[model samples]
Target: MATQPTMSEKRWLRALGATLWPSFLVAAGASIVFFANIDPETLRLDSLPGIEISRMSGYAIGFFMFWMVGLASSLLTLLLLNPTPERGPWH
Candidate 1:
């Protein structure tokens, strides 16, 4: 017979899977936006307007930021919803 996962394990697995894909999607989308907006030839420091700076950096930073946020949020949600596992030598 196949062994069933404990509830907490199942929950964490679900959360991890859910978090991973969405984070990847967000990162990919942001990278796309970054590549789309900024001209490689015109990557000068003084060329960017204030708003453009925010938008451009948002694309770059948001990619990683959102990914981390998604991962952390999912893990936190899992932790909040599931009971804590007991620590042991094997655990």
Candidate 2:
């Protein structure tokens, strides 16, 4: 007989998968931005007009923001996905 995953195993795997997905998305986005010569510093996302930050800091902020956005979108999609119905013995 086949065995199902334990609750602890499922939770650990799920957490790893969740983290990896967002990390991969952010890494890919960073690579694309780098290749495209996009400057994160040029982005005017500051809440205060007089405030300034370094390019590295801008990139860091952008990375975290992208990861959060990707995570939320993925979670929403996952929650919306319906499971398949079970088959009957007669079918």
Clash pairs, candidate 1, are none
Candidate 1: stretches off by over 4 Å: 39-66, 69-91
| Cα lDDT of model 2 by residue, 1-91, tens digit | 9899987677657766865687668656865676367666556454535668877786777777767777777666554543444531111
lDDT of 1: 0.62
Residue 62 displacement (Å), model 2:
0.8
Cα lDDT computed for each candidate against the true fold: 0.62, 0.63
Error of 2 at 16 (Å): 5.5
Local accuracy of candidate 1 as per-residue lDDT tens digits, 1-91: 9999997788657666776877777668766776578653355345544434554554556567767876677656656654656631112
Backbone clashes in model 2, listed as residue pairs = none
Q: Count the backbone clashes (under 3 Å) in each candidate.
A: 0, 0
Which structure among the candidates has the greatest lDDT? 2
